[model samples]
Target: MAQVHLLANRKGGVGKSLISLNMGAVCADTAGARPDGRPSVAVASADPQGTSLWRAARLADQPFDVLDISGDVANVALLKSLPYDHIWVDTPGWAEITPEEYAAGKDPLGDEKYGTLLSALLDQADDVVVPILTEPDSFEPTWQTIEWVLKPRNVPFVVVINNWPPAEGIAYVEGTRAFCEGHGWPVARTVIRRYRVHTNATKVVTQYHNNRVELQAREDFFRFALEHGMRTAAAKEVVS
Candidate 1:
């Protein structure tokens, strides 16, 4: 069975899709062929916007299979049967409705369809990756999702600070890390810095390890995957 990873956060514009694609690329690139000769990595997008699917389509040669399983009960069910080592699911940018809300029919997100799909994904996921921005505005919703949704389900998770500005100095980065640690949250030591390479990723088929200029970004993501248990021993051996 594939280990399902959900890239999720209630906060919008937190780089969830970007991180999902990059990590999927890394898994596809490093994991090699499976015992059955199937691809090692696959990506399933549950986002209504289908951004990941669109990006995958634009690539000249897709490294791995990308599936648009948004709001489809049958497609979501098909995830368990996929013959891959790692399966990454990209979820929408809203917090899932609580059971209380669902029972009460409050439907805070305005649709039971989305909440149901998200709930199913969370239930099936082996690990969750919460991408958060460095700004103060992103802090509240990030913690809220972790506390209200992920923690309640006892899901294992790690917070990655995305789009960190290089000029902000070590003090800013350390402060964010300290804050998360103080709250007893696991935070990735590797911070993905702001770069044009990442911003332009959607328009091209560049992997993190492809260009010399993207070496730092590549290392950051590679370390993040290793620390978060996303990479296999064989992948780590190749990196080392």
Candidate 2:
């Protein structure tokens, strides 16, 4: 069965699509071809926006396949049985936060259509990656995603701090880390730093011209991938 990695956050505008594309590419490229000739990795977009699918379409060649499972009940049903070693899902932003919803203790995924598709895909998620910015405003939603959704359902996840700048975001980086620590949440040791190369990236980092900047960008993901892999392996070992 393919290990489905869900890149999700209650709030949008994070690096979910970018991570879904490049991280899958890195793992696919590194793992090389499967013996059965199937693609080693794929990215499935559950986001209504189709950011990952649209970006993959623009690429002349993709290391991994991209699937548009948005609003597709059939596709989501057979997601786990797909012939890939790994699958990354870019989930849509959740429904708007309303006082009534909170008071009622209801956590909605989105509108009816979106909620249905998201619920189906999320059911098969083997792993979840929650990305957040350094700003304090992103914290409450992150907490809601963790507390109301993931924790209640017993979903395995990691909170990764995305788009950090070496000089500009140093303090905020620490603040974010501290926040995660206070909550006793698991945060990746790797910090995905901000660069024009990432926010404006059109192609996979490996597909870039292979310059120093691109190499650095790829390394950041590689490090995180390594850490993520180890954590996943450890979890499996414990389960076994």
Candidate 3:
């Protein structure tokens, strides 16, 4: 069975797609870094927008399978039976709904138009990698996201602070930690700083290690992905 890592959030623009692509690729690129040769990786996009799928198409060489399972129930139900070691799912932050439905009150997880797909993916997830910015607006949705989707299911997760500007985010980063600690949120030590290379990635991070800036760009995800992989393994062991 593949160990699935879902990059999820209730707020968009938190770097879910970017993390999906990099995390999956990083796990794939490391190949023999793990004892079992790390095997295969598949990134499935569960969002209706398919941002990850669209962006992955532009990569010169795809290191892993990118499945568009936005509305594919059969495939999602069978994800665990797939032959990959890891499968990263990029989920939607926003749901599709009519104005009437919106007025009625939206589902924090999703709406009828996209709810089923999200539910299926969530069911198969071994763990969720929740990305969020340090800004105040990103906090509430993140809290709602974990409380609504993860806690009920008892899914283990790591809250990764993304898009951090290293130059001036020291206090903000520390404050995020304080905030997470106050609320008992499981947070990743890694902070993915904003980078031009990330905003315009054409290849996997490993492919850009020749340059200093690029290495730094890949460093953040490398650490976080490794941490995530270890957590997945540990979680499975406990389950066993």
Candidate 4:
């Protein structure tokens, strides 16, 4: 079965794009890096900004290819026809959008365009991964999304806390933990602490905040992949 991972969040500035491309790069590396005969791994970018495409271009030397999911009538049809080992979906930030505006822009569902993309993704996916920010305002929207995705959809998903600041006081992290635990959210054991490296790193380049390469950040992501059982050590070959 194909592994469809959605790098989604209802709110923007939550690092959805960063996680999506990183996950796609990792998955592509895991699948042996080549596009042909190799396991297919593509990023179905639904954002107008084309952040994923830019990132993919930056890493064009890598084995895999990044396909743009242009806002065409055939977009969904094309996605449905793809045969890949994993499809990493970079969804739009829609919590700030009005309901009507979002619905008009989506597929059949009364959601964002990414919602239509999500519908197609869920059809082919066995798992979905959501990135949630630790801020309180963002937390409510994240949960709202969880409720929506869970309704009548049996696809399994896990939530990762992004942009986590260590000096934000213990109450913040504890609050997030308690909220996830109380609401049955599958929070990952390793929290991605807010590092300058993470903030400074671009899509293709490996620069970090402290003027160093953040290999540890990549390792943390590898661990996430392992815990989720999405990929194993074999996938690491694509990175080199």
Candidate 3 residues lying further than 4 Å off, grouped into runs, are 32-39, 95-107
| 1 against 3, candidate with superior TM-score | 3
TM-score of 2: 0.94
* Candidate 4 residue-wise lDDT, 1-240, digit = tens: 445667766677787777777666677676764445664677777777787777666653544556666474345545545677777777666535444654565322345565566566566555567777778888877775676554447656778877778788767777887888798877777676665655443442222223333665666666776676633232334334
Candidate with top TM-score is: 2
lDDT string for model 1 (1-240, tens) is 888899988877898887888788778777987787767888889999987887778666667778788968546756767788888888887754666884785644445688778877888887788888778888877876787778878877888888898888877778777777887988877898887877764432235446666777677777777777743344446657
Local distance difference test values of all predictions, in order: 0.77, 0.84, 0.82, 0.64
RMSD of each: 4.9, 1.7, 3.7, 6.3
lDDT of 3 by residue, 45-65 (tens): 888888999889989878888
Task: Give the 10-residue window scoring lowest on summed lDDT in candidate 1.
Answer: 201-210
Candidate topping lDDT: 2
CA displacement after TM-score superposition, residue 6 of candidate 3 (Å): 0.5
Tell me which residue pairs clash in candidate 2: none
Q: Model 2, poorest ten-residue lDDT window?
A: 102-111
TM agreement with the true structure for every prediction = 0.84, 0.94, 0.88, 0.76
TM-score of candidate 1 to 2 decimals:
0.84
